[model samples]
Target: MSLDQAAAVMEQQARACRNMAAPLYADLLVHTAEDVRAGGPCADAVAGWTGAPSTAAVPLRLLGGVHALVLTGQAPQLARFYPSAGGAYRPEDADAAWAAFRAVVADRRDAVRGWLRRPPQTNEVGRANLLLAGLLHAVQESRGLPVRLVELGASAGLNLRADRFRVAAPGFAWGPEDSPVRLPGAWRDGVPGWLREAARSYPELTVVERLGCDVTPLDPGSEDGALALRAYLWPEHTARATRLGGALELARRVPARVDRVGAAEFLAGLDPRPGTLTVVWHSVMRQYVPADEWARVTAELDRLAAAGAPFAHLLFEPYEQDGRHRFQLRARIGAGPERVLAEAHPHGLPAWTV
Candidate 1:
């Protein structure tokens, strides 16, 4: 993309990120802003979003007061535009202040756009869901009991513990006959029944093994990490934070077992025992891997499967430009076709049939 186009895209992304970030930091913006300005992934992330690398660093400091104002929930519109620590705009001039902020951003659009050019993560969740559902489906197809799952990008391992959550359908239906927590997401039209049947059919599913992969696994109970997690949430998504907090509680009690490893290489060396079905899965982790590494990973998996190794691969991933998250579940049983049992969502919420 041209520099200008790239800039626009960056600005667009910033706007979207703002929608998610504003609300998250409202409660602890003042305290967190200090943390944000201290220089870390969070600070870098905020700077990246604002598009002013030089001034980008400043936003982190402002985060404290700006977020505190938001948490107050009174005339937040003005607080959002003019942080409480004395600004050019008075609280009384709400509309004008917002307009002014927009104007400032518009003037700096080029620089901001340059920084916002990171790849989009839109269909990532959908892709993850698709792969997950397909893996379970494969187990049922084989009449296997008690599946084992190993995932990359465990992200608090929430999805890894998906079975523990109630998955529902449109007509107020649910899955896992005796699941504990209710999952939160919009299920596809027929997904509930399909999922329910999948569960019943795979009654043998014991989930003997479940683990995840991540460079840094966030702990909600940790005061420091909780702030970071909250900041990552979108301002418009209070419910998501609440859900995340709930997930955190579950995590503290029963966290996703994860192993730190390089994505493709890690899976390559992993050897599954005979008769014990080994599955390798990932959700939207491709973006993080370099092309060469991704190629190596693919080749490695192919070799293992070709050797007649008893293994399956599930990928719930998306191709962003098309806005489609295809579920691709491939299994190797004897010298047979690289079977694709199903394709669902990267995140499994609002899934589509492929």
Candidate 2:
């Protein structure tokens, strides 16, 4: 691909970053687009890619690589401007930040190039806010049976421990009170009154098993794996960084198995256990799956339902609504029709009643 076209992609991502409240990433991406147009080290790092620059989440991968350098203390000068690196962004320091970032791309070309090849996997903990709510509905539907949590495209399975995190909103609360990963204002306008019955339908969820699948599953307990998860988070979003820290700790304490397999194959290998609520869950990752593979996954869900196993499919995936994308929490219980339970931010914070 021509550098100009690649540069436009970066600029497009910058617009998205700005809209997502990541101004630091937006500014840096502008500089990155310029660097790409100039055929600088950024171009060299992405040289190996042939099909398309966006095939590997080009912009996020590039930013994640730079974030890794800051997190690892390999780019101290650049780290000084990254919030997640314990530094702050200053407009006056923009030129210096770009210089340091470019130097990292130039000097650590191999490292940056390696990051370019890997897809960005953030394993966002905030999304657990929506996951937990859906689990609540599942638990209620299963007649309070023990939950068997199965997730598709679960990166490090940080969110597999969703039940372990504490979620609180106005006049509502759930999960352990003393939990480290505290999610406040989980529901928009303080837990909508319409869904109070479902929220209180079950005393508590009893999770018996936690299993997930990813083409490339990450080990949260390992340093390299953890760094990859952290690197993908927007550096300016300190709240997400803190939430990740808590989720990582929860992952250590809460044992969950993430199989290194495709979502369809993973679902194909499982049978629902009797007297247990099999809750199949996934979030945001649905977009990456091929249409045929995703159809197979849905078919597997259908198989489980036909088997007469108490099952629920809870997902937080984007759906087109009114000519735009909407991140929705959809749930299905025991072959019943799927229900659109709620809506939330892309990061899955502050959900509102549908």
Candidate 3:
């Protein structure tokens, strides 16, 4: 992509970051984008980026690299801009931070480019609350049988442990109350009756198998893998970071396997079992997939549905509704009609039941 196009995309991503409660990252990315347009060190650091500017997540990858530097204590000067590192965010400090950021990029140009070569793997454990709710809805419809879950784009596979994480909303709660990973502010509207019943009747899921696939799956047990996951998170969002830590600990106790395979290839090898509810789930990952591969993935989903074993497909993705981008939970069981279950924040908090 041209420098101009990349700059514009970064600017748009900056606005999105601000809207999503990441002002620090938004400010840093805005400056980075400007520096790129001005043909400076930041431009050189991003010179090797070859993915589509619009959807490559280029801005986030760059930010992740810088965040990694701060996390690893490689750039002490940049620590003042990171709230998670005990720095306070002041609107006036953005300019000085930008200068420091640019200097760091120039000094660590090769390291920054290395980050751009890989996709951001946020894992985003907070999103598990929404996915768990969707799973419960599917279970209620499918005779409450044990489920075998196969997730696409599972990243570190943290959400595979969703059933083990604590979830609380007004008038409802699920999972272990004492669990370290707590997801509060779960629903904007009151919890639905279906969800309440599902939680009450089946407090813990009988997950027979949990399998996931990603183009590059991260092992939560590895130091580098943990660093990558943490770096992708906006440093100012302490809650998300805490939840990730909890998920990592939980992953050590309750293990799940994530294969290094493409989504379509993973689905092609899956088949339904007669007595189990075979559920395919993914969250906020469909956009990154190529159209041709996604077409094949859809066909595989149809094949699973038609296989006659109890089946469900749950997805949480951005859907344009009335000219607004809203993330919605959608579910399809067997050959039944697709249902729009709820609308949710991009991070899966404060869901509004439909």
Per-model tally of clashing residue pairs:
32, 0, 0
Runs of candidate 3 with Cα error greater than 4 angstroms are none
Q: On residues 138-167, what C-alpha lDDT tens digit does candidate 2 reach at each position?
A: 786666899999999999999999888888
Locate the minimum summed-lDDT window of 10 residues in model 3: 46-55
Candidate 3 TM-score to native: 0.97
Error of 1 at 269 (Å): 3.4
TM-score of candidate 2 relative to the true fold: 0.96
lDDT of 2 at 169: 86
lDDT winner between candidates 1 and 2: 2
Model 2: clashing residue pairs? none
lDDT of candidate 3 over 102-220, digit per residue (tens) = 99899998898899888988998878878999899989888789999889999999998888898999788899987879999898878988889988888888998989999989999
Ranking by TM-score: 3, 2, 1
* lDDT of candidate 2 at residue 237, scale 0 to 100: 88
Instruction: Provide the overall lDDT of each model, using Cα atoms, as 2-decimal numbers.
Output: 0.49, 0.87, 0.89
| Cα distance off (Å), candidate 1, residue 127 | 7.0
Candidate 1, residues 1-354, lDDT tens digits: the string is 322332344344444344444422332333233334454333443444544442222333333223333334433443444332223333355445544333333444443343344222111222334554666665765557456677876655655665554555555433445544444454554564445577566643566677776655544456744544543344444445455555555557655676656667567767666666667677766666768988988787676566654567666554544574354434444334655544443334556444
In candidate 3, the residue pairs with backbone N, CA or C atoms under 3 Å apart (3 or more residues apart, or in different chains) clash, namely none
Minimal lDDT window, size 10, model 2: 47-56
